[model samples]
Each structure stands twice: as C-alpha cells, then as structure tokens.
Target: MAQGEPEAEILLNTIESQTLAVIDRLNRAILMLVTGQPTVSGYSAMVGTLRPSFDQIAQYAPRWGDLIPDAPHIRAELAYLLSQRGPLDRLQTPHLWAALGLDQESVRQIYQSRYGDLPSSERTRPTAAAAPKTEPPSLPWIDASLFQSLQNELQPIYLPSGKALFRQGDPGDSLYLISNGRVKVVVGEGETAKTVAEFGQNALVGEMSLLSGGNRSASVYAIRDSELFRLPKASFERLVEHHPRLMLEVAKVISTRLENATSGKPRADQALSLAVIPAGDGADLGAFCDQLVESLRTHFDCAHLSRAHLDSALGEGIVDAPLGTLRESRLISWLAVQSELYPCLVYSADPTLTEWTKRCIRQADRVLVVGEGRGTPDLNPIERALFEGDSFHPEIRKELVLLHQGGQAPQHTQRWLAHRQVADYHHLDPHNRAHFDRYARFLVGRPLGLVLSGGSVRGFAHIGVLRALREAGIPVDIIGGTSAGSLIGAQAAMGWDDVRMEQENKALFKNVRRLIDLTLPVTSFAAGKGFSSLLKQIFGDHLIEDLWIKYFCVSADLTAAQLRIHRTGLIRRYVRASSAIPAALPPVLDDGHLLVDGGLMNNLPVLPMVEIIKSGTVIAVDVSNPFYTADGAYNYGDPENGDSLPFGKVLRGRVLSRTLVTPSLVGILLRCLEIGTINMESVQIPKVDLYIRPPVDDIGSGDVSSMDKLIQLGYETAHQQLKGWKGRPPA
Candidate 1:
C-alpha cells in the first residue's frame, strides 16, 4: 500500500462503475433491437459513448493489468461496436452477443430476467460482421516505458463532462496527461469566461504553472468525460532530473504559447497595429516601412498610416499634442477600433522626436525599432527615454529590426541585443523583398524556420547554404538540425557566419586522424572523446536558448526509443549527443538516456520547426547522401591497377586512406543508416516550403579533406535553387 493507494482504488472503482453503466446501456439498446424496436440510433449512440472510455482503458490497461481484468475484453468489444457502420438489424442476436463478449445463454437469461421471454425476432437477424483491427497511433513524445516505471506514483483521475479540473488562481501542484476525451482552457468566470484553447488525448496541460511555481493562470474543464494520469510536481521534478530533454520540450511549449499570446494568428478582422520607430539617427524608416507594408500585403490587408495619412483619416490635428490630452485618447480609441476594418496597420513614426511619433508609439500594439546594421547600434535619446520610462505601456510588444543595404551578415547585432528587452530581433536588407516577406510572416505570428539535415562531414555544405540564404537577404527566425547539422546550426545560431564556419571547419579537421580514438569493440569503434572535445572548444558552456537566434537540435534517445529535441540545455553536450553516430562514435549518456545521432530517426528535422512556428515557410537544407546500393563500386582506380594520379590527388588519398578504408562493418552500418535517413527525408522534405538538396552525393560522409569544394557546391546549389525567390539571376 502506498500513500495514494486509496485514491487509486477509488479511481479504479469509479472507472469500473462507468464501464458497467456503458455496458448496461449497450445491453438495453441491443435488447430493444431484438424486440423489433430497431433501436439503431440508440445502439450507435452507446457505441459512440463507449469510444473515449475504451481508448482511455486501452492506453493504461497494460500498466494497470490485473486491477482491471476485463478492460481488454471491453476494449475489444468497443472496437467492434465502434467499427460497425450499419444498424443492429443486420447482426444476428447470438452473433451480436458474442461480438459484445456476452455469452448467448447469459444474454438470453439476462433478457428473460429483465424483460419477458426472448423475442422470436432474434432468430431471423443477419450474421454479425467481424471486428476490424486497428493499430494505435504513434506518439513519439510519450514514453510508455517511462510511464510504466512511474506507474505506482501516477494517480489516475476521471474528469466528467463540464467538470473543472482546476480553476484559475488554484495552487498548481501537478500536471495532467490526457489519456482520453477533450478539455477546454478558459480564463475568467461566469459571463466573462472565454475558452482560449482546447486540448485532446495525449496533450499535456497544467505544466506551465507547475514549471513556473505559480498559481494556475487559467481554468481547465473537461469538455467531455475524460480520463487523465496526474503527475504531481515531485514526480515531474524527478522525471525531469532523469530526462532533462523533457524540460526542453516543455520550454518549447511555453515559448510557443508566449509567441501565440504576443502575436496571435492573423485574422481578416484582426487589427495588428505596428509602430516603426527609428533606433538611431538616419535609419531610413520610410523605406523600411514601405517594404514591410508591401510584403504584408501579400498575406494581409495591410495599410501604411503615416502622420499625414493619419491626420487626414482621423481629422485629428497632431499639432503639439500632449501625452495625456483628451484628443490623444480619442485618437487612440479610433485607432484601436480600426482592427475591425483591417488585418494589419503599419504606423510609420517620424524619425525625429515629434507629437506624431509619440502618438504612433502610444497607439501601437507592437513596436519595431529600426536601426542601420552598419552604423553604431545605439538607440535615439527619445526612444531610449520612452523605453525606460514608467509611462511606457508594459504590454506593448517591442522588437529591434536592424536594416542592411546589401546582402551582408548582420554587424554589431550582439551589442544591440545585449541589454535590449525586446520580444525578438531581425536583420533585413530594406531593398530585399524576401527579407520583408520573412519579416511580414514574423509580424503575423508565422516565422520562417530553417532545418539543416545531417550528413557527417558533408554538413559543411550547410555553411555555404547559410551563406547563400544570407546573401539572398532571407531571414531565419528559428533553426533546428540533427547530428552534423546540429554542430553547424549551433554555430550559426551563435552568430558564426559562413566564412567563420568554413575557417573553423578547416582548422578543426586539419588533422583528420586525431578525430578518431579507437575504443573497446563493445560500444563503438571510437569513444568520441576527441569529437566531444572539439565541440566543447567551439561552444563551451553556452546554452541552446542563449543562442543569438532561436535554435533546437534533435538526438535519438536509445534509452527511451524516441527522438529528443534539445532546446534549452548546454549546447555542447546536446550537439555531442546529436552527432554521436552509432558504431562510429559511442552514444552520449546524459541523465540516464543513451543519446545517439538524431539522423538515425530524423535526418531532416523539419517537424520540430513546424511544430514550434505553427504556420510559416520552412526551408530544409538536406545534405544527406543518396541511398547506397551494393552494386556500386567502392574502388576508385585501385593502386594495384597502376592508374596514373596527380600529386595532389595522391597526397589527399594517402591522408584519407587511414580514415576511409575499404567499407567494413562500420561502413555497412552507416549505409543502412543512410538508407533509413533518406526514406525519412522523402516523407519530411515535402512538408517544408523549400527543400535545398546540395549536390554533395559524390562526397563521402567521412570526407573532410574537400571542405572548400563541398561548401562551394552547397553555395552554388542554394543560389540556383533560390534565384527565383528574388526574381533575379544569382550573383
């Protein structure tokens, strides 16, 4: 007996009661049908009612086992009933009894006991159809084994329809994982209560308050009869302690919620007002606003309201207007009401300190502080004062938007972002339509995400592709990758431009042989210590969340048998984990899980990006090798053949000979991995808006000697692929 055993018993009893009630309803419906009442609708309704409960029991039956001995049988019967299309008129009375797992004699005896004698109509009924089999839906995030391990600690709770799970302002002690039915999240109460979101089976709710150590922000109620496993704070903390990546996933959910709250999904009548103010002198605010408005018009009914336009439209002369004046309040009210007319409104603030600028700032729901990327990253005095002032509305979202003239990497961005309390930051070439489009997507709460695919040393090509994207003046709001892409994406997120990455790649692989430290034959050929050291040298102790851009990396968790997305932990450790190639390099054990290359599961991890961003243009750069065939020759003019070779080629061959020997067991495993990865990419690539497959198939995964060539190929491939984006030829 445990501390919560009584509660668990009570929950089980309640479930049994519900199950019996449903069975009683089903039996009565069947009896009615046999009596010539032909209660098809009643039978169908009972089957529908049994579905959620069946799903709930099915999910937890393995864990509960003997506690609910009849769960499996009930579930099977429910499956059959739910699968049936037509009425009970088709099913024979005896067959129906058997299909429902009720013995024919028992059903007749029960019918005789309840009503009168069994009706003769049962004899003429049609034969019962066989139950259709169904496979369970895949839930990659939920670890069944993990839950089984915590079975004793887990408390099962039944939430009936319209019942509150927890109300706003209640103490948050646990989070619930919905096993069945749907729940709606609401804020306020009575007439003011508004349903903000609804979550169904397998959705995690009540985690935010548990993580933040605060009272519940909203009330959650069961929209239907639901079964949930409540994991208390203590158990959750222990789970997180053993599986740190779970924290990362939770953080991502929180980040998504915050993003949604700040910039909700764009609607036809949703008025998203944005104020574009200069960060410093000579920001070219007009050009920036014009380009932004143009880009926004592609997706939204956008209107650019400058000072003159506002004055003309509202007839509110902004001549030396004070902050708290009645005219200012009236103007603000009028602007706020414009949301019903337009989907988006862009307010272009005057560069200098003026009444119009102040009004613009006051009226906006969001503010973009535009600055010249090439100039000193400093805020104008008036803007600085307002930002730091108590009078500034705390709820108004602010973001720094740095403008560049040409397709150059952002300059002095770190200095600008160092202490600035903004929701986000972006680098845009004012003249580039692509940049504006990307920003426009950001404004509408849809952001562009870039997913870099893993291909060992071939991932250096990602640098070149990144270079091309930068040169094309396309902004990446979020980035994710697996294995080698993790390494490259981390550096990119840390603000390493392509040139720096290329230089670093060359330097790191200067002595390619040093990367391998052969270990015991049990785990891996290499211990991966050297590789880990290299990653450590590069990223140090930087956190993934602390990167210049929002970044995440994926790793295959061998312990949990699922892919883990690392978004908040130490960058070096997760990168090491993500790049831990099976057999070639030993898996990295972090907080009890053996994590290997994420390429094993998801070579091109576009799903994480899509999941986080919700709706946006997702660009996936796949540097994965094509599927290998056994018939393909590995020998490139064997030395025994006496083929003439250039001195440079001979030197390169000798250097790589030690690392890239004839395809052995490791080579076979890598090939198999690649085959699986390619199949996965085939499915994932189509989900993205753009897929850039660089011509690096000729290059071997272990080939780092031709870094420059690989990078150049990547750059050329990306440029050619994206040339149509700018409606111009590639430079």
Candidate 2:
C-alpha cells in the first residue's frame, strides 16, 4: 500500500503481540480500546487481522519526537508532530510517548490523510475510542479456527437411547464430551429433580468443574447411557496453559450457556384483561368475551399449576385450543398488525384464526383480520367507531387480534388440548420496548417508569432530567442514554463532584451487591443459600489462606495471569489472616487508596439484564468503568463482581430551567415524579445503611468444611477466626 506500509503493520503487530502477553491485566485497562478478546493471543491475532479505527487514530496522532526539551512526555518535536491539540497529557511522565516509541503526529496525519478529522467530540480525548461496529460475539474468533488445533483433545461419546452414564453425586474430575445420544442434566436438592438441560451427543456435562476447578457445580445424570469423549482435568489444563486460543472457543460457549441457564425461558409481556360485566338490561354477552380474555391470558402468559412454563399447555387433555391455529395464520395476522400502526384494533370476516395471528399481535407485529371469509368481519363496534373518527384506516387492510369477539370460541384453542407445542418463537423482541412492557406487571416497578433516551434524533428529553437533578443536588444513577441522554450529558458529564461522589459510594457498593448476585450461580441447586452468601464465601475470611499481603486484581480466569510480566497478577487478593473486610460506616478506603476518587476508581458493573430489558439505571442497567457505550451497555472483564470489592457510582446534579427541555433533562425530571411503585429491591450492597451489618459475604466455612476437600479443590483454608465459629473436630 505504501513504501513503509509493511513496517508500520509489523510495528503495530509487535505491540499487539506484546500487549497480549499481559492479557489478563490488559483486559482491566484496554477492554474496549481493542475488540474481540480478553485473551492476549486472541486480541493480538485480531489486531493482525482487522485494522481497527484505533490504528488509524494512532497514525493520525503519532508521537511528536524521540526526546523532549521540556516535559519530556510532552516534547516539542513529538508535540509538533502528534499534538493536533498539543501534548501527550495522559502518561504520568513527559516524553513517555516517545519512550513507548509512538509518534502521535504520524497517527494524526494518517487519520487526516485517510479518514479525515474525526468528529470534534471524538477528537477531544485520547480515551474517546470509537466502538467496534461488529457485535461482541460476532467480532471474530467466537466460532473461528482458533480452536481447530486442539480438535483431537475433544473426545466424543455416544449413548444408547435410554441409559445412565453418571448418576448424581458420582465424583469425577473429568468433563464428558458428547459425540452422540440424548442426555439430561438434572439438578435439585434431594428428591425434587429439575432437568436443567437436555443434551444430545456433542454436549458437555461437567465442564464447569473443569473451568472453575470445583466439584461438579450441578449433579449430572444420563437420561440414556450416552457415549461421550471425556476431557480429563489434566488434558483440559494442559490445553488451556499451552494453547490459549482454545480457551476463547470455550469462553464463548460457556458465557452463552451461563446466560441461557439463568434466563430459563424467554419472557413475555403480561396481557391486559378486557373485562366487561355486561349491560344490566341487555344481558351479559361480554361474559363470553371476558372468559375469552381469561383463556387467552392463560395461553399467552403460559400459566400453569406447578410451573409458569409456557409449554405446559400441550398435555393430553380437554381444553380449548389457542387462537388462530393455521398454516399461514401468522403471516395473515401480521398483515393486520402492520395496518394498525396508529394504535387501533382490527377485525376479520370468518373469526377463525391461526397460531401466527396471535403471535403477530402479541409481539407488536402487524396483524390482519381474515373475517371476510366467514361473514364475520373482525371489527368490534368500538373499533368501528374509532375507525369512523379521525384515526380510520383504509377499508381494505387492518390490524386486529380478536377476530371472534362475537361470544364464540375460536377454532385454534384446541391445539393446547390436542398437542403440547413449546415453540421457539424465533425473534429479537426481547430487547424491544413493547416486548419488555409485557413483563411490566411482574417487574419491580409497576407502571414502569423509564427514562428512555438515545437515538439519532430527540437527544434532549433526557438531558433536561439530568440538568434538574444536578440543580437539586440529588444523587442519581443512570442507565441507557439515547434521545433523552443526548440532551442531558451534564448529569453524565458533571457527575464528578465530591459530595455527590461521597453519598454515591455506598450506593455503588450496593450495586456491587447486585452485580455479584446476578453474575454468580446463586440460584444453583448446589448453592444452599442464594448468591449473597456465596459472594460472602469468596470475599469472606474463609477465602483461600494467607490472602493478607498484597493487592489482588480480578480477571475472568485467574490462571491466565501466569502470562503477566511479574508473578503478582494471579493473587485473588491479599487477605491478611483473620482480617475483616472494610465495613466502615461510610466512605471507607482500600489499601490506603480512596476507592472513590470523586471521579476516578469507578468500577462500573455493566448490566446485561438491563440492556436486554432496556432500563435506565446505571447499576441496575449496565455500565463500563470510566468508559461505557454511548447507549450505556457495559463491556469488559468481571471486576465489578470481584470478591467483595466495592464500586462507586458518580452522579450529576445541575440546575436547568423548565423551558430548557432536553431528553437528558427529562430523564432527571421524571425521576422525581411518583410514576408508581416498584416491587424490585436492589441486589447490591444489601440495603445496608448501618455500620454493624455484616458484609454480605460468608466467612465461617473453613472450620466446618473438610480440610482434605479444600486442599483437593485447590482452595487454601483461611483461618477459622470468624466470631461465631469453634473449630469442629474433623471426622
């Protein structure tokens, strides 16, 4: 491409490779700066493969010179070349950019010559990196050949149609690789068994044990004695140590599995009941319609006796089939739903419908009433009246759900009685605002109050909210920023004050509580008392012994730290024997470092659940540390949920006139309004306002747990100095 193109590429490649040499630590600092991996090699390989915009930025803003006359890190030669804005201000020392052999001027020139000047907003800060256009999973190497070299290490097993391979509680250090055959993973506490997942050949049973080095997280049993190639702990460890690329493939699979296991079934919005007791003199014609509503709600909500599972409807029994059961019913119904864009109803001719019709309307998709075929035009009198008014649609197409409101049962209701079909119902509505509203009633807050923002247009509605909150001196946590957030950049921008930061420290810790609860398998059958207790165990006095002497950094995988320059990165924490966690009344500092630095030390725990649901709470939603997505989804390794580590939430409080209406301001203003009550309790920080409250973690397991098991599990037993425990004699 150019005379020096290969040299430039090679230089970039070497930096990428060296940077990956410290992947575990690098993840903490440079997660979003580079894309595609938490693994060093994985990230380096991607660097060689994809030319990220950062590279362009680097070329455009290359360092000024090799040596600095004054403020070496900010040298004139380097500043003259690289400093479009002037000076390398980030490094603690001057001339450090030169020391790193980076020329900011060259990077700036490269960017200008090729991509041109970046947006004014983007050019202001070196840290203001452009987000990768690719989805995180689709970034690369998720399903790539990174793992192809280790194909032989993966053994396959096949099982007969009905046989048991491993019974529950059978001790095994190896994880099975499924080649073929059906298998079931059943989990429960004595007698009450729930199959977490059904596996076919090529599935895994005890991979979690191999991943975390603990006993099987869940007891696995073969529904049918299936044949599988099992990866022994030794083989798996060797692969991970030598062939780190292979670890990335497993990370993708495991992260996805973890998300799936926790989310159980795709959630649906609750259906509103349209109940009419009937006109007194005219008789209760709407009674049948009311019954119809009840029946439909049960079907849509997927209600049942034991479990609310949606698929339970298809038991061999007698009951009405669900609505609109047909081959192309969904397509037909979608036509009507599409026509009803302005929020009016539609009716059909025959009244009979198909499964697709119900699906289409429920999902906010377009619907079409096909009543013209059966002389039962799908219009209700109310809908007809509305159509006649200002909002009428054309006489041909319309959006209608209840085609047969004429006191009659639709034909499709029999499918539930006739056949039990738990459809996958392929779609991405789970992230839609309309779809999320379906689960509104069940959510913590009723009449859900959302400070929605972010979009190419409508940026100010939320900004107004932030400005007012700033004015009121209120501590506010935020979530997704869009149409509204665009205007209210102040709250996000100005959330750096001290008093605000002080009050928010506890609030942030409380959020840290939620992060841990959400991330950990506290709901697992293996976990006896929920996630809070499990976190306590990890961060507790019962932690691996002698964690007393040094700082412990958090990484997705602890062992990956071996790739670090020093032997220091692997320690989970320096737990002094019998030392208590910093449970000070408030504003507690850590390792002599004030964890909350007014603006620094922000451990933003990105909220996956909230992003999926699209809420607007910083902690309740998702957040990156100091860096976060424009829409506010978090991206990174798991530092927020690290063992008992607290986080800080920074809030913005600025005053704004009512006349200055922006989406961001609107978000802040709306927070003060009493929209409704929320049933949700924050999972972080345990609602702790008092200093006496025990840390949400547990510290009493060392004396009670078997020493042999602890050693075998690779967890050194912390001293049994917990206030309530007496060392029990080991059996």
Clashes of each: 0, 127
Each prediction's Cα lDDT score?
Answer: 0.66, 0.29
Instruction: Report the C-alpha displacement of residue 584, candidate 2, in angstroms.
Output: 44
RMSD of 2: 32.2
Worst 10 residues of 2 by lDDT: 596-605
Relative to the unseen true structure, what is the C-alpha lDDT of residue 580 in candidate 1, on a scale of 0 to 100?
A: 83
On residues 1-731, what C-alpha lDDT tens digit does candidate 1 reach at each position? 32333433443433433433333322322222123121234232222123334433333333333322233233233323322432332233333333333334544454344334533446455444332221212235535444333444457677866678999999999877654445788999999999777665445678666577789999998755566767688876787787676666566655664565454331121236678888865487777788888888877678788877767865557434455543444454344334323557788988787777776675565789888877776667657755777545543568888877776655456677764678777777777776677667777756778899888788999999999988987767778998888999999888788889999889988988888999896998897888888888898877775564678999999999998999777899999988888888889888999998898888888877776666566788988765446434454455667855456765687787733224545456655556656676656666677888898988877778879988999999999888876322111
lDDT of 2 by residue, 163-228 (tens): 456656656677765432345666765679776655542344676666676655455544333345
Instruction: Give the TM-score (vs. native) of candidate 2.
Output: 0.22
| Candidate 1 off by > 4 Å | 1-271, 274-333, 340-342, 346-440, 630-663, 672-676, 725-731
Task: Summing lDDT over every window of 10 consecutive residues in candidate 1, give the lowest-scoring window.
Answer: 29-38
Q: Which candidate has the highest TM-score of all? A: 1
Cα misplacement distance, residue 433 of candidate 2 (Å): 20
